[model samples]
Target chain A: MIRLHRCCIALLMASAPVAASAASPIELTARVLVEQRQAAADGTTRIVLVPPARVTPGDAIVYTLIYRNTGSQPVPDLVVASPVPGNLLYAGPAEKAAVPEVSVDGKAFAPLAQLRVDGRPAIAADVRALRWRIAAPLTGGAAGQVAFRAIVK
Target chain B: MMNRILSPVALLAGTGAGLLIAPQALAQQVRSGTAAGVSISNQATVSYSVGGSSLTTSSNTATFVVDKKINLAVAELGGTPTIVARGATDQVTTFTVTNLTNATQDFRLEADQQDVSIPLLGTDDFNVTSVRVFVDSNGNGTYEAGVDRATFIDELAPDATVTVFIVANIPDVAGITQANVSLNAIAANSGQAGTLGGDVVATPLTTPDSPTTVDIVFADDTGLLDQPRNGQQRAFDAYRLGSAVVTLRKSARVLSDPVNGLASPHAIPGAVVEYCITVNNAGPNVANGITVTDALPANTDYISNSLTVGGIGTGDTCVLNGSIEDDDAVGADESDPYGGSFDGATVRATLPSVTPLVPLNVGFRVTIR
Candidate 1:
């Protein structure tokens, strides 16, 4: 009797659309930090990033996006998108495993060289959002991070 | 003896008959005069016949004197010069209007900017905001808002004086060294004349001892009728403006890690730079509406939330112990001395008011891209 019930439930799940039955297994988080100069025990100064409690104009800020796969199976063709805050001007993305594409209106995406504004090539200042495409599949319990810099307007 | 007695008796009887029968027939005469001792007297007589004999009697004389007169004078209370600043309100000059008349009278007050030209400096004309005639209710001679009453000198008693305040707003103009304003007081019944009533002819007498008649004839010391006495009582005040000077200085330092720990910092990519801007005002007067702005350096990214302000030492040294104020860390208990904000590339700081000799320091950090 238990085997018959399991078979019947499997048939019902199969009748539904495959895309509708599937669930996203990826988790994402965003964080911001500011750079500061600190002195080491050896009397040498080093640049370090720290969480910011306050910011002023002309201050540089770093935004980081973290991703993790929580499902039993591998997640393929993963893409991440982040919108730049209005009060900050886009600088550039930090070095990462995959190159990132930029958007001026958060609609269309293209490489940094192909992006244009007012029929002219777009500069770093014109970027409004960032998109990253991961080439390698993320296995369950696997994680990765992407970051970019911006200056307060 | 019989004739004499008959004649005396006849006279007495005639007088009695005249008093009783022709009392209305006797004419009583009167003459007009002024309080200046112009003589005025009245007399009356009566006549009648008794038993074919004629006799007459004369009555006693009556006299009266008029005492109607009004006079007033206005003078500056003190010759001291008043000091005023441009763009200042409630600048006041005081004067005393005295009613010298023997009878009570009302005086109208007026203020005007005189045509006194100071060609060397500039035009000294300024309009008065308001003119108030106040009776020193407290006898303090100083005008108090709620204590002093704002009204004309209505029925000012003889030998009574009232203080008049001419309030004016000084305009903001350059090269204005001095200002002259005149105050005048004339009797209310001066018939549109500019002087007190003393100089004008007294109104035609309708009734004896009427105070109104005195106003028509009261004249000022200048013998002018219904005009301001004491020649408008001009008051001169001096105007002085303070010179304001402000100076701003800025400095920046870069900090970066070197291959050798003992080496100094280099301005390489990813290096952090700190900037300090100091503003000083050397002035005799406070500088109002002060603002400081600094554009972010090229090829640099501003460290988000890194803007701060602190009181610095005499030099460019940043005092760590000094109260460090953060633009983003404003809490309910904390207050920012200067309003600060950023517009992508530039940082702005606004100070509502600042006094002279005070130095203001503002600091922020940026990173090289």
Candidate 2:
């Protein structure tokens, strides 16, 4: 009777449906861009975006991060983080999203109002790294973008 | 006849005995006269009556030896030698001139350079300009212009000493191992009045002595006839003029965007470059009022308020970040050890003082245009 019962349990476990492993749905890409102003024939200035190779002091540069859900299902609790280069000073966020959190040492993160440097409220220039938390789920085949601007010190 | 014979015999015997005692007394008197500090005299009294009464009287006699002696001795006041720098004036040497004379007298001062022969040390001779002699009024052993009396020492009392200053200028020359200056003081005649006292008399007793006195006269009770004439004393001092040695070194480096971050920084536009000027004083003397200047390099512009002057400590690290200011303007901080200013395209930094074997650094930053 014990052997018959054990065989019945194994068959029942084998007949149950097996769950498949989930694949990462979000894909990320980052790049740095510089702005160039050209004079139009009408005597008006127009800004042109170009890839950055070399920059002079007091020049402004932009960092952009793009994300797309590559899988069929939606991605939740998505977090993207980018560090401000040591030689560049953080100016401000490039886009308006859920206000991004900033870190002075690239270790701890907090909202802009809560971030403190040397026991005092930190300014934008003190930011060393920034992180964004997506509030809405990232739908499949949907792309999202975020960016920040900095000056070459 | 018997009475007459007795009287004659007695008279002869008495006369002979008196004569013998008189000779012995004369020999004793001569022996006593040879001793020092002793006076001898003898008196005889005679009683005689011309007509009826007797009279007595004695002759008066006085004897003394006069003292007329003058001696001059001089010596250097301080045992240590003096140090004099080239082209320095009023390099004074103090001396004490004491009058060993029994009477008041004057002394004339003169400084003469002695011939020195030190191998490898430049010629021992150097011209001493603006030689002035003065009597130290305060007796502090240091020369003070207004306090000291620059006058001929007249009427130096017997056994009195006076301090003398021989001021002279050192010529601008090097390698002087032993620059000897001799101060000579010679005794002058009585009533001599002048900076250069009247020429020494030919003889201390001459009615009108010669320009220079030959001998000093001394008369005493001992009746000694030999005494030195107008005496001269001398004091010498040797001076060593040291050299002031200084060396300067300059280095420049770009503080931003170094090619390898460790060495060989590239000079790029809009980059900051720091220049360091090191001034070293290796001599034994302290250097004062040291000024360092550097012109802004071509293709670069000076960064205002970026200058910093400091002292190079043990390992060439900059210490004392002195306050910077515009050229000739007062700095906000007064305790800074250095002061800097800009004139046109050049940066000037002034250091208050620098000691031997110490290095001072003057640095400033400039941005390439």
Candidate 3:
């Protein structure tokens, strides 16, 4: 027996489809803690990503860095150099609490001519986003977050 | 192709296709099954004894007397009706009302069941996302008549009410009909004339009705255009005594066909972006051939192949690229003491398209006379 249900209506005009935010465990694997440790320069208050992780194809990882200036004298040309991971997609703009600078490879550098944090966004870059430079000098015992995105490959 | 694709005018100008929609009961009717042996049976009759009224052997009246007898009618037949939820749009919620029992037992979900049927109708039909119902005494799901008599607000008795509030797209839908409307809201037993509660039944004393007026809203961005200047200065900055600009827009209006195909005219509706650049003129002694350049956004395919400046050796300049309909002149009014004065003496070029990360170079060059 077929019951004609007029309940269903409008394709484009039907009730909003509930946004299913339900998450299922598609795949899960835990990594050992020893495999994910980064070493920073001595006396310098910044840590560098020796081997960056690719969270996704086009995702830039924002690492929460904790740095303490061990030295007494205030570091003037205080530059924090974190290279953009070569494997991931390009990073857009970055946010810097202290100062900002940008580099492609490890060597050549460009003074991030324009450093700004929006009343809203942190920075704007050509690439989707990843790394950014804080162009300000670090005084001592100062920490902040730098955000950037990676262009999807 | 107009309707085949979306109607552009309606998309940009007016909201076409009001939130009103027909019941999308479309089906491809795909089915798969093996033949379970088909069985056929004739309709059987149930004969229940009436106990309320006894028929006189020689009754003067021809009317059959009604009885308070249990009508145990167990007429068994085969198949069950399948009601598949038909529409697939993300606009409004819909529900089905099925009279499955032989005597049309008005059934509602536990939530949509009502206490009374006099005022408003019970939510037998699903129209919105969730379902609601009424049961006064035993809210714990005893639906048999007289067992746990459901007390609901009755609209007919002027105490109960039933209303189905279509909570979506209220602004878009205009016409609502009350043909077979079941009430979800009612003010009943105003002065203590009625009991506290009752189970609301979803049955139509009259015709069925649906709500009109649906709401439709769109998402949007909030902020305005803002930029943090990079070292790269525009050419007009060099040409500024007080203020000046490069007339590169002429290149957009009058450039030759490039080796590539001609680009579309730069006159799209929502494709203009405002930009500012600063340039400096380095001098040995009054470098006369100074020129500035500006590049079109990469998204726009160049109509003419390339852009070239006739003479650029006097001063720095700033260039602005935008839609053709815009009448904003680059160097409208200004003076210059740093170098020779030229009103619209900047260069212009159109890039193939915008390449993120990869810099699509768009700058002026000096002849260095």
DockQ, model 3, C-alpha based: 0.00
Ranking by TM-score: 2, 1, 3
lDDT string for model 2 (B111-140, tens) is 767675434333455556777788877767
Q: Candidate 2: which docking quality band?
A: incorrect
C-alpha lDDT of all candidate models, in order:
0.55, 0.59, 0.23
Give lDDT tens digits, candidate 3, residues B103-160: 1111222222222221222112223233323333333322333433433322222111
Query: Which runs of model 3 end up more than 4 angstroms from their true locations?
Result: A1-54, A71-73, A94-99, A111-137, A144-147, B1-369
* CA RMSD per model (angstroms): 54.1, 60.3, 40.3
Ranking by lDDT: 2, 1, 3
Per-residue lDDT over B202-222 for candidate 1, one digit per residue giving the tens place of the 0 to 100 score: 544353433112223333455
Candidate 1, residue A105: the lDDT equals 62
DockQ of the candidate models in sequence: 0.00, 0.00, 0.00
Error of 3 at B186 (Å): 51
What TM-score does chain A of each model score against the native chain A? Answer: 0.77, 0.75, 0.36
TM-score of each: 0.32, 0.35, 0.16
At residue B359, what lDDT does model 3 achieve?
A: 19
Which is better, 2 or 3, measured by TM-score?
Answer: 2
